[model samples]
Target: MKFVASLSAAAAALGALAMLPTTSAHGPETREEVVKFLDQQATAYHCAPAVAAYTAARKRSWAQKVLGGAPIADQNRFIDGYFEAKGLDGEVVKKGIKELEEEGKRIMACDPVVESKIRNSTCVLAPQSTEGPYYHTEAHPIRSNMAEWQLGLHFEMDVGVIDVETCEPVPNILVDLWHANATGHYAGHPEPAPHLRDEKPAASGLRRGLLSAYPRTNHVDTFLRGALPTDQNGVAHFVSTFPGYYTGRATHVHIKVHNEWSVLPNGSFTSGNLVHTGQFFFDDDLNESIDKLWPYNTNPIIALGRTRTRNWEDSLQIYQDAHDNGYMPTFDVEKIGGVLQDGLVGYITVGVNTSASYKPVWNPNSGRAGGVVEQKPIDKATHEEL
Candidate 1:
């Protein structure tokens, strides 16, 4: 992995390479550009390995594990020995911290809300929740607008990204999002369940549970699912509708962050390290307000007189996410138009370590992998050099 000497040479080389739909308007358009930026970033931020070690240590400590999240000084102590053990000078980490402090002051002087939202962006090695049953590696198009005429209140999301190790904004990374419709059904999955009662099952013994046997997707609908790249400011904007509640889970949205991924000819992606797999939750008041709307009020679970799960009641996943180390996975939402009937907008800053890696779990029930860590080489539309 050789680094380009200068941005001028990298830009000249990128002039001949093809661009993909996942490229941000202001971000790197080719793999060479991304690699160049990463090479420069690596020189300044060397705390990724140290942060990963601290996260693992926290999981092993019974006291820290019981308390949920540890203090900042305690976490710093855990990583203090890492630099000495790896023979890295401590001045590098100090320099990175000084740079972040300057940026934080500037952002605070500009807008307090922006600075406050990203203040706790720390690296989390684990996923907030398990990738639910409705995930597919192929056929997810790269676009901003994911709403395909689904009847519900409009939802506009602006997701901010930052490297937790250095607290610096991360650009050119892919943010993949998907959620349920107003009727509590996900697109491309028309199978009949307690929520979706229209289509038949793809297999005979497919059941509904986190550990139950799942079935492969039988349809090709990609509504309410899409991917977008972060701009120079490390933000990805998406348009959709507020998701309705499912049988066992609260109203939430699924998200995944892809680093160094390649776009295929079919508009899907492959050969990337999945750095983050998490879910974002909504406030109870907002979910309650949306529940009284027209289409959301007509869910099959409501028709069947079954109780919908709330955030507090969904203890296993939601509780862990809310109290997890350095991760605030809930969105801060507000009314977009004068009334809630028109639309809503939400914002959240996702903290991740770009250098960290995780393997995608294999699900024998569905015959498909859970998330993408890396895959075999293929012909990329961007002509990306893997």
Candidate 2:
């Protein structure tokens, strides 16, 4: 298998209690309340408008996840009392229910005609997580397509960005994505390799050029990893295959947002700030289906051969903890055709603070984390390598 791989500062009490209201001194009782609440809450959390929207709409432990967890009922009571104290009203209390109803309608009305439909889906703000041992910092360029692998069905994701500051779409931000291949292998990793490739990855032309360079691992196969900028509507459409499950983690994808970045004269990178770094997960049903499939069943680490298998291991408690904290976001999966081996679509919106700085360091040989490791190009005329 291939190796891969935030807290708001609210006081435990008052920060957990009120969190500055989205309504007004008078109260938000109409549709206009939507804009006001979104702006206010988004600004307070230093997140995106979509997050505020989901928090206000989902009406779950969002506050507890962000602020603190008392009890949902107790939290609601505190919120109502706090809203009353701040001069808000019932409309604000019921805003989340309305948002839920709207989301239900959208899910029921899913359409497949649009080639690049994602930002239009429901928005949810998620918790932040570390990139783990596998996040690479080498010079990988921005590209949209990531379906250059031999195994697994197609998985397309469209990332939507919400500018929490303006409660509007975040245009032109970079979306970085990376995941393991179906055989539980990551490109550029050199250890814990599979016993046999079945003459597959190479035979399929997927592991062609890079296989010879790095014999110890699949370091040359940069499959299922790429980056691209969001469009005007704050969206990036990506193509990839459903990833294979690896040891110590569940089925998930790693994401990072860079607000300002550029390639430099010396082949290095220059950037402005880190927008966001988080993950999106799949439905349990989807996970189970993948585990029971062909190449996924070939996962070198996981045992039991699919039946009764679950993604509940792999230092997985951290992810479960994040979900309990309400910082984890899940993609709305749409699997089409018989035997999920066909293809599917997953979507999620990331909220980010545009002002954060880019401070990242990659440690190769750090637990065999498989990701980008910079390599020098060879000079043809001089027969010299730099």
lDDT of 2: 0.48
Q: Over the stretch 1-386, how does candidate 1's per-residue lDDT look in tens digits?
A: 11112455434333433333322211234676544533433332233332232222322232233334432234333323322222112345334344444343333233323322332233333344556668778877888999987888998877766675554456688999999899887886655544444443233332222223225455678889989988654668899999987665678888888876889898877746677777887766677778888999998778767656666555234433443443445675645546778687666667766765556664544322355553334223231333
User: Candidate 2 residues 226-322, lDDT tens each?
Assistant: 8887765466878888877654456678888876678656433444546566666665566777777787777765553333224333242434433
- Evaluated with lDDT, which candidate comes out highest? 1
List RMSD in Å for every model shown.
17.4, 16.7
Clashing pairs in 2: 2-184, 2-185, 48-164, 49-164, 57-96, 126-327, 127-327, 188-219, 248-314, 249-314
Best by TM-score: 1
Give residue 174's error in model 1 in angstroms.
0.5
